[model samples]
Target chain A: MARTVIYERVALIGLGLIAGSMGLRMKRDGLAGEVVGTARSAKTRDMAVGLGLCDRVTDTAAEAVQDADLVVLCVPVGAMEDVAREIGPHLKPGATVSDVGSVKRAVAEAIGPHLPDGVDFIPAHPLAGTEHSGPESGFPELFDNRWCLLTPVTDSPDAVERLTRFWRAMGSNVETMDADHHDLVLAVTSHAPHLIAYTMVGVADDLRRVTDSEVIKYSAAGFRDFTRIAASDPVMWRDVFLNNKDATLEILGRFTEELFSLQRAIRKGDGEMLHEYFTRTRAIRRGVIEAGQDTDKPDFGRGTKP
Target chain B: MARTVIYERVALIGLGLIAGSMGLRMKRDGLAGEVVGTARSAKTRDMAVGLGLCDRVTDTAAEAVQDADLVVLCVPVGAMEDVAREIGPHLKPGATVSDVGSVKRAVAEAIGPHLPDGVDFIPAHPLAGTEHSGPESGFPELFDNRWCLLTPVTDSPDAVERLTRFWRAMGSNVETMDADHHDLVLAVTSHAPHLIAYTMVGVADDLRRVTDSEVIKYSAAGFRDFTRIAASDPVMWRDVFLNNKDATLEILGRFTEELFSLQRAIRKGDGEMLHEYFTRTRAIRRGVIEAGQDTDKPDFGRGTKP
Candidate 1:
């Protein structure tokens, strides 16, 4: 099938995993006529160009966004405001400005005021990533069968629909949601779970009785999964918690309450309570598998042998 | 290579994932001359026989263990004593009796007194499993390259050596550790993590504002991993916590302490603290991947296109 070119020119303002993946997928499928990428670090820019992640690399975000019909801020949430300020004057008129930040509300608040009058600011977050970052860590298939959510800050159906079509061309299912609700939902799904994983791994690291080698060797039992989650980019997650503070903290408070109850049940030997709680959670796993959001294969179909 | 037969007859007392995997692997490699299995549920016994998990299915534990050179109690930790009592007299005089329980100390205490004078009791735990459980869920490759820790309670080096050979023949690296220490190590590696996962999933389920369907859909973010851990067999996990009370509670206490500190960092907007903690956890993940306990590929190399 012949692919439709959604944008004549697309600019990615940070050459990290998310932006690199978007550039690769767009180039692979001919979804964009020309992809221009920029990064604060010169090494990342050179790597992105060398890897063919974009058609060209620029030294500044302002240069990358010039004359681009679509501009995406792919930097960390904490850096969104500065990038927005730097490229605000260079953006093309009537261009759609979006982002791939984990926290939508904060990103919008930071970038909303800096944009020019005719540009549409549509905040988007593609629910796709690996435990890796940087320009070299992306693949064209990263967004395949994943979700990309858009929270449009302006009343521009044309731009929203166009961006939606672009994400679908890259093999992502697109949905639009309220920015506050997006942050809250993400808090429940991503932010709080990451913090908990980091905490568990840290606790294991600090324990005096169990050596680090033992923890690593015997991790197949359960802890290995947490280690994977905790291995995600440290700066990205730190900014995520700091930007989406209220929602993440709210979800963490609720998590602590629930954990305390389960801990009490363990102390009291309330086998019934534990059994019921565990049984109830299985339904959610089934839901996730049925939704095609995750693999149901045993051990995520990981290789059994080393 | 021609396979070596470690035991003339091996009896499995429960037709669950571990025992079924053992039977299938033994049958595939000819590790045992005859494999017999018995389960409390007649349906499970029939399925084990139909799936060829064992050479034969018996109606009772005593019948399964009759003249068996090795008898393995694969039931829950809470039911170890009862199963041991039922099969004690039927076990061969020179037979080795072992278990594949998660909590070793409690299992050793439960089954130690029930065994006859001549029978050797050695508690073992194979740190290998998927979220799924049951006769049909077992696969021959489940224990390949996985750690199987042995906490032997008997003085018979011959019996210990023979059992170790049996596990090795089935593709496991075997190690011996003190039962109490094994329990504590497992608490750090598996028990506490499992509980934390369960608590987080439960909290997500109970949040009314975030609908269950939404949680399931957006689960790819990070919560999906926890759901897989939370989906494990409820009865088995219940018994694990109830049996390994002290170690699990101690680990949970430490986990809570670390969680609270991270929570405070988030509340105080202490990005440095969060970054350092997260960065520290990444080293453990590298250790796990380097030790060959987990895959370093992105997302366990799960299929991207569903």
Candidate 2:
């Protein structure tokens, strides 16, 4: 997993779920020569220091990225550009800067112009997470059995290989795709689904006739699933929707059309149509389980056992 | 658990998730003198036999209930009336008859009328299950943290007490409620949530561009939860929806109205409204986890040992 000890120092600006996992894994596998992390909140810096998630914790992005050979931004999508600008002057010459945002194209557009000429901007998106947020919520095994899609701005083979090795050491299977393709795939697989969950949870919340007690008691059935999604960090999801608006809206449009059709099946008492639609989705669930995207045992999101 | 040994023989008339779990617990705790089970399908009978979920798996409803001191009908709400008609003559005088239906009032109305006058009709609904059905889906722990509400029309205190003991032995906390109330509570919490999941999954299934591969690939975002619910045994859910139509329709009407309001929020770019609603639902999720109705873990249907 040392992967040739590529980077001298890896800077992580914003130690939330993804960065925290990266820090823990870097420590566990010695993937980084030195791990430097920073957070806006003093509380988070203290926690990162106490957890030994990094070799250094700093108040500003400049301090975190100074002299680092690789810099990975793990902040909310909305904050990427600002963080990039803050670290632009301090970044090492010929350093590779990447991110773990849900939307890659927007990230590249937002952060690409800020990096110095010699520094490389290689945007990456890791398709993994739990609803929990902040440093303490992350575990070393969070990236295990998950996909880490790299959307490189420039075809820097050396940069790509180095970053790939870094993520591989962190326990993620790596894939390279274009920025827009990454966004489109995410819009279908993650963005639209999250929006729908947020929508459903909002809907259930509006149902005042059903007391909170009743909804809580019977969540085991299905509503709990939506809650799990809606419970996702608000700023992260909000940024994803806003940044990936076009693709998300496209998927949502398709989703609404399909929903209306199903609505008709229910209204028409067409059990056959309903059953047929339901039967088709099972194959997708099976495919996911077989593809190792999901597990047969119910995932409670307590962090997978090592 | 021998708490008066309510019945010498407890005959479970359907060896599926609920009934199989009941048989497992009763045998595990020695709550009944003997545990018997019945299934219409020979394949199911064989599976139940292989699982050792019952001492005997009879094919006939009449033969299954004969000489049984306690008779539990664990079948679809749609089949309860016909099953009652089929097993009425075989029930011993003064023996108790209970069921594990989602809509208890309708079950009481449909099945209670068909029971013999001497047979005590005590309708019960267990608030527990996995998306999986059939005898193989059950485990002794399925009912460990769930509630089993009994709706008894009979004024026989002794009969109600006896059934309570049986459920306690099955690892359930029993709550005695009227049939109509049980239907209303479940409609809000369980049935409506299920319908929404089914509807969402159906919506995803109809999305032509979001290939099945993509859905499976990015299922962790949120869609997978609905897939699990929508993947549930269709016939059982079909029966649930058809039998509990009034309650289902009522809750669904409320849900649709709420959903429309949220859609308007999204369409109008009402971020405050969206944030406010999303924030409130988090409280309900907290309550559900505290109630132990759901695990606080993220991605419930995704992986093992998380």
Residue range A162-218, candidate 1, lDDT tens digits: 999999987889999999999999999899999999999998888734464687778
- Candidate 2 stretches with Cα past 4 Å from truth are A1-4, A208-212, A300-302, B1-4, B206-212, B260-269, B297-306
Candidate 2 residue lDDT tens string, B196-277: 6666565555553645465566555576666676777776776776666677777766655665565565566666776676
lDDT of 2 by residue, A177-254 (tens): 888877877776677767766665665565545554655665556667778777888778767777887777776776
Worst 10 residues of 2 chain A by lDDT: A297-306
Listed per model in order, the count of residue pairs whose N, CA or C atoms clash below 3 Å is: 0, 4
TM-score of 2: 0.93
Residue-level error in angstroms, candidate 2, position B182? 2.6
Candidate 1 ranges beyond 4 A from true positions: A208-212, A299-306, B208-212, B298-306
Taken over the whole model, the C-alpha lDDT of each candidate is: 0.89, 0.77
> Which candidate has the highest DockQ of all?
1
Kindly report the docking quality category of candidate 1.
medium
Provide the DockQ value for model 2: 0.48
Q: Which pairs of residues have clashing backbones in candidate 2?
A: A295-B302, A299-B300, A300-B297, A301-B298
